[model samples]
Target: MLSLSGLALFAGIASAYVVSNGTTCYLYPESQIHLGRNVDDTPSIHQAFDQCGTNGTVVFTEETFHLNTVVNTTGLLNCLVELKGELLFSTNVPYWLSHSISVGLQNQSTAWLFGGTNVTFLGQGGSINGNGQTWYDENQNHSNQPGRPITITFSNSTNLWIENLRIIQQQFWATFVTYSHNVTMKDVYVNGTSNSRWNTVNTDGSDTWNSRDILMENWTVVTGDDCIAAKGNTTNLHVKNVTCYGGAGMTIGSVGQYPNSPDYDENIVFEQVRTIDTFNGAYIKTWQGETAGVSSNGDAGGGGSGLIRNITFKDFDMINCSLPLQITQCIYTEDAGACETSKSRYIEDIHFENITATSRYNIAASL
Candidate 1:
């Protein structure tokens, strides 16, 4: 994305690799951005972003330091920049910024929202803790006035690579992307420890609501909610070699007039996955509510005709998943809740091979 320019950091740090932008920086073998210092990583990060000629890299040192917000209103994470850090070794953003997001609080963790083409956020077995304990209890009286502590927010980009990162304990969806293409989130570990009971809601691992060329592989997701959620007219997505535990399994089309403004999910692939103790192994159905986001599909779409086609799930092993494979076209109508059911979303060209399951509920495939 970027043309190599003044990459003092990459040039100093490593010799064999690709820099997002042509810009270079020497990532000193021994470097630390102390909490209290005149030197800053944000500037260094943006410097790479600046030189990406177009794309760049943001590498974090092995230190726990607070950070200022790297804001991008264009809904893009600058195509050439590379944002990486030495995981568990370096910490950034000690607390959330109140002025940056919709309802940001001190402990909110989903602080850094990133998206762009040719962008990579790689870390070495480190943790991006979204200290969600501060704002976990906003139920009736308040909406999410408290910001969701997510690792990254991808919007409208192409060619993304997120690997070897441990994203944990966020207040909301861990990684939420919208309108992007050719994305890959691999070798990623998303976890939600029950340190606080209220600290978990919608902690989705990787959500491709409306995009394509998505690939999520070799991942372990133990979250408070859906491990991987697909929504509204998504196309050409792939989820392979993953293990999901303690949440909803790979979900497609929790459809409720979603895409909020566009096409739905199609051409998805889920292979070599194992699910354990979750709500459902693979779900494809529209929700009941559409007008508002308050209730979880209480009264929704005219029914999905958005084509959940060409889906392939092979070599899937399930153990004790509550409701293993449910494909329902049944719509939840107003008067009866389960009434309107006439070709909701077309589930064509679907194939399930070498699938083994031990579910409390029967393996029901609604065609």
Candidate 2:
């Protein structure tokens, strides 16, 4: 078993020495490679990955790299991605819409896909810029354009580590981990806001789906959506030492959608979490039974079943949070009478311990 402390030490050492040791491929600013202002560096970035993917490191030094096209780093192995520079995705909505990879999850797509086994992304205080202002404005105006792409995605991966990264201005969910296992995300920061007059929607910090054995710690997240959300088929998940501001707080599910498909989430834990100006502190939400046409994205719903068990939320503090603790079987529906009439998923062995909270509203717990 790899210890967290040992992983941290290795990350520190790798960030410092990998470039100098010739195991690193430095992304140099070359005119031919399109490495400067208004230039698309996608080809050069792919070249670096091809040259130094396995058993090596790809280092982005303290400069700006622009990406107008999608970069797919799937199936990478035994590699470290050191981002000490700004990775700015293009704000050109039409180009991204035509180029991004559509994963078909509630209209979620990604500008970049980072996956495969034994990969480490050490940001070292670097930033991943999504340049989401244009997307926000476009969505506010059109509302039917191709959905904005997520910042980063880990799909079908194992033994992944992401640390010390600042993800900014996400178009959609900041980071998404799906169909993966043995993942650790520590000391990460995410910030997103509406640059236009409209409010940004669905900018979750990080969300896990169909994954297991994940650990997230020491995160500072400010978004318009959930700080961290576990969606479906997630088990043995642990989250700790997280601070959330101006978002919906830590959440388990808006699960039980997609009828005839069964989902389960078990052995989840959240500890040492703090929330300020957040909407809710700890939440578990599920869609009521046999519902259809219930998604904001106009996706069909219903025919999903699930069991959420052995969930724990402990050592949490909330200030000015609207709903400190909320557990509801009905989500996306305001009709309590209809909810009571419908069948919902089962939730068992749920525990909350040592929670200190003050709600902006007089109500503290909504269950």
Candidate 3:
């Protein structure tokens, strides 16, 4: 278990709230709170949040809490969440698909929507299990399956700290921070894979969108999609000391999706990354041209403009990874002639430094 007690030393420097001397509220499995082994704990959790929203700490003790309903803990102010137990989301795919909160960006939905100012989530070697095997199987067979909910999302929030969490089997992206600033995620583990037959798809480890002044470090991710991805309108981001296995590598954009929307990502840096048996490492991908309708992943968009600048990837060690370095201006398009004629986004002032890798495929760099 990673202890966050050391964070107290740097709390002042980092501008993070430390509840060392604050009120402590413990949440339990109680019938009165509608929290039990089988009962939904969403209400109880919210009640705790209400009680300990400011200058306090909420602790989830070592027990299994079943969440059959969506829990939105947005607008939390100066609180600490200590997770020392398993937080399991129910496998009722249809129920969640219909009931989850619509996040309104790229058709994303979430089971847990956490927002607001100066919030900290410290998982004391605990797990947030999404129970995603059913969703993966359903998507494999049903071509028109409903959008699966994201495991956890932080949106429209600021000054957040998330550390030492074991997040597994996410139905969609594991941790998504968007439209926020001054966030830090460290010592986090994310895994979405199958030992049996079903395959997880689009289980990105962490995604940042329209956010700035973010830092992600000391992460271990084994997923089907990008380990860490920076999407449009992101700036002043830094990522380091991340180990990725069986996923798409660290990426910027799949941007330029919404037509006429100006996207910008700048001053981003990824350093000290280690990749094993992954797809791509240190990549930048963008869409091209104006055309769309029910695109891949049941989404639709095109002809968005963007500017990517002052980005750097350094100190990467790739072992048996495919496409160690890739920069593509044309993605999700088949018409070569159209791509040639389309007005693509601007990409400039990019740097790749101290990258050492062994490619599983024969190709080294793709541009």
Candidate 4:
């Protein structure tokens, strides 16, 4: 039987339309909110300019919608939008030969990079499922890079909250929060598992770069790639109360640059994290010239500025890990490592506490 989630999953091919050159779009059950299901809502939902405020709450309400193009917000600034839904992949209606439901459910798969601030995606006991098995399976027979299905971008946005949702299999990274601040991701689960063949790749849990004031808690990550990663000028960030089953354990840096620029990172905190059946415990790692790691990404022994500092890793219980923690400044002229070895910079303090490896590749700390 086809996965139930596969049946209910929206192809995610939405196109943004201009609405009287509007500035804000209000949605809720009370207002004249048109959901994605109704033809009226399609125009109203698309007409939303820069902001989609509380004027309405666009609800999927047990429906599957598609978007064949980009959903742009007309370069809106400091805008706020709230989308609430209660959709479950488990509630998929069985497809029958005499079915009324249509075929070609798949939409023109593309990246959905959302650009907005103060946005809230609340799906209490619900999910915005991404059935990525087809994407992963496609890569098995060929040498093609998987397409990043939808990019929910929060560029230069502040006080963003993405909570109470389960993000499933994807063609690429599940969630990418870049250049944003005061972001909180609560009770989120990102999974890229296949019951048959290997249907996962580059399906990162959450990737944060050049951001600050973050809180990632109550997460269950079971991906084939990094569980949660931080990259570039990310400071004053915190990852607490997380449970990661498989993937490269909590990556730090994939940093490296040319005279065009350098790198810097600081003030990071990770606590109460659990690594289960993973490859590494927690990485305070900087990558090679062309490196990539989830938990983090920094250059090792590069002559720019210390890209990492004030790091705190505490109360982490290890279920099964392959490699422990390793902290060493790298030398571009030599091996791969951290950017700051004998020197400290933009980064000041580093702290780690209370970590246990139930099944690991190594021990506690390798700093």
Candidate 5:
């Protein structure tokens, strides 16, 4: 979290609705009249970004903004976003299914594609609500829905600072960072609990893929999926002071999916974390080699090569966790002997230190 005083990008650019301060420009959306309506704020947001997205600030001042369309605001330069309001997505299943932006990762899509250089976002108690109960009830079997958008995505960007942001009931993963670098998020909260009979599936708190130099701390995640997952080509990720509930704690991979593409993840660390009623405090799951298929849950993978190296999970407090630490190389494979016989992904220099876990099972870990 960076203060406005610390912003050093002094270049000035102003427009009709954009105002200029000492070194920072500001744009307050003029569409406050459309608050809480069926009207979309995506165009207003795009206008503000186009006007004051470079060396400036965009202030979301309304109490609530209803969005029913896709939002893609990227390539901003040295901007700060002040969120003093809520951004709520509509539950039009058919509309979103056709309009969500493709992320090019395992049939995933996103409601918003947000990224930029030197972008700093400070959410002053504001939130992004996905209104996921609709999706949950629609997809009753919890199967993967094509074009079900993640709440937000940071992609193809650099130098992002996001703080004090809350995401509730995301349609899919709360946040996904891909092909980005030098991203930091702190004091973030995520909740994806379902109030209906249908479960909230695939609602990962945060996931990173093809990214580097990421730092996440002081996050509280309540979801049905991974709290934080590092997918293929993730490097130098350090997550600390995280508290997870009812999720797959901290995870590395389900990688090694593409047979031709090599998965390389290295220098990952998750320290001082707390998991309650989670599947595992920390785990690494890689697909078995010489195999390819999709699972019942619609996760398609297998037959890939890779190396996971220099990973550490330290100082974890796991309460009633199934496995404190797990390394499964044969995930998604039915053959028990295939884990040993198959040419699987390689793991080296892995360490689990100072773990205090009370597993429901007798075995503390499985490797």
Candidate 6:
């Protein structure tokens, strides 16, 4: 149920300090901020999480920390951030389209709404930099541009621990976890590239909605979209040794899209994956209950129902991937006989074990 407007957007308190016990707040970067002139270290990083954020330890030793405002810093507990510096964000985009921070999903937005509990984000080799080439040249026609933020959001809170992070140029979807549970993202290092042909579209590399016991391992994504996405009410998700170059692989659900809302993805798992040119090394997308609209990345939805059960895609290794296995209940349907006469939203125990693929096309499993 989460979503009391996503817990009131992670509450308040932007300044104050006192709590101690191994405390260690050491941030700094607004002495007339440098490197292309940027300032506003977001209120001294919310006053260093109001000084050591609880059980203490918030060191971001400034190599660059611009962030033109908005960084919720929710109810932290046994906190510790130590990202040796480099946050950056801020191509301004209309003051982040009037101050970002919306976790209600789909109409996504976030410039960091990081939550509470036993949190720990240690990017020893720090980096966030969502300078996303001016939102990929103003979303070069891939639409869905409502204040494009999503470069940091691990909502509500739990026993979270994001390690060795380095999500680059991401103006959208580089990490989004909702409500939160025992989250654990390891050695992350995403790179949503684009040198002005304008197509770092939807750059997803770690996405989970409504969340549960999540755990993404040793990632190394170079995105375009979904290197990892278990959307909808995702439950015990666990992705292992990931490595995708071009995205859209290892996904589950564009999801049952809101026909009176009832979607629940269960025990999901993608293990030891590796896709190079990717389009799909393992993907699944639903949407065709009573139909709906908008999705060429504009992301609207359909008549969602629910239940995508115990899923698993193990040991995949696709090189020239185009579709090493894909599923679609006719997402955003354009009359495939009216999406085969509608009503489809319960994908059961899906599993694909030692899959080894090499395809650029010529149909490699597309259902």
TM-scores of all candidate predictions against the true structure: 0.73, 0.89, 0.90, 0.68, 0.90, 0.34
lDDT of each: 0.59, 0.82, 0.82, 0.54, 0.85, 0.82
Residue 76 lDDT in candidate 2: 83
- The digit string of per-residue lDDT tens for model 6 on 1-367 reads 7688544432321122112234776676764324446667778788778877899888877477778888889998998888887888878888887789888876888888888999899898779889888988887837558878888888888999988899898888888889899999888988989987778878888788888998889899999878888889999999999899997889997787777778899999899989899888899987776655665547767777888898999999999998889888776767667466446567888999999999997999976
Tens-digit per-residue lDDT, 1-367, candidate 5: 6556444322222123344554444544334333433666677678778867888888876457777789988999999998887898999999999999999888889999999999998998788999988887888846568888899999988999999999998999999999999999999999999899877788999999999999999999998889999999999999999999987899998788778788999999999999999988899998877555665447776778889999999999999998888998877778676566336578999999998999989989898
Clashing pairs in 3: none
Encode model 4's per-residue lDDT on 221-279: one tens digit a residue.
88876788776667777888888878776767644332224556677777888888877
Model 2 misplaced regions, further than 4 Å? 1-23, 29-36, 141-146, 335-338, 341-344
Over the stretch 118-205, how does candidate 3's per-residue lDDT look in tens digits? 9999998678999878777777723224557889989988899988989988888898898899999999999888665766678889
The order by descending TM-score is 5, 3, 2, 1, 4, 6
Task: Return the clash pairs for model 6, or none.
Answer: none
Show model 5 residue runs off by greater than 4 Å.
1-36, 141-143, 297-299, 335-344
Evaluate residue 294 in candidate 2 and report its C-alpha lDDT on the 0 to 100 scale: 48
Flag clash pairs in model 5.
none
| Model 1 TM-score, 2 decimals | 0.73
Is candidate 2 or 4 superior in lDDT? 2
The true-versus-predicted C-alpha distance at residue 23 of model 1, in Å, is: 2.7
How would you order the candidates by lDDT, starting with the best?
5, 3, 2, 6, 1, 4
Instruction: Kindly report which residue stretches of model 1 are placed more than 4 angstroms away from their true locations once superposed.
Output: 1-22, 25-48, 51-57, 68-70, 73-110, 137-149, 258-262, 289-294, 297-305, 329-338, 341-344, 361-367
Mark the 10 consecutive residues where model 3 has the least summed lDDT: 12-21
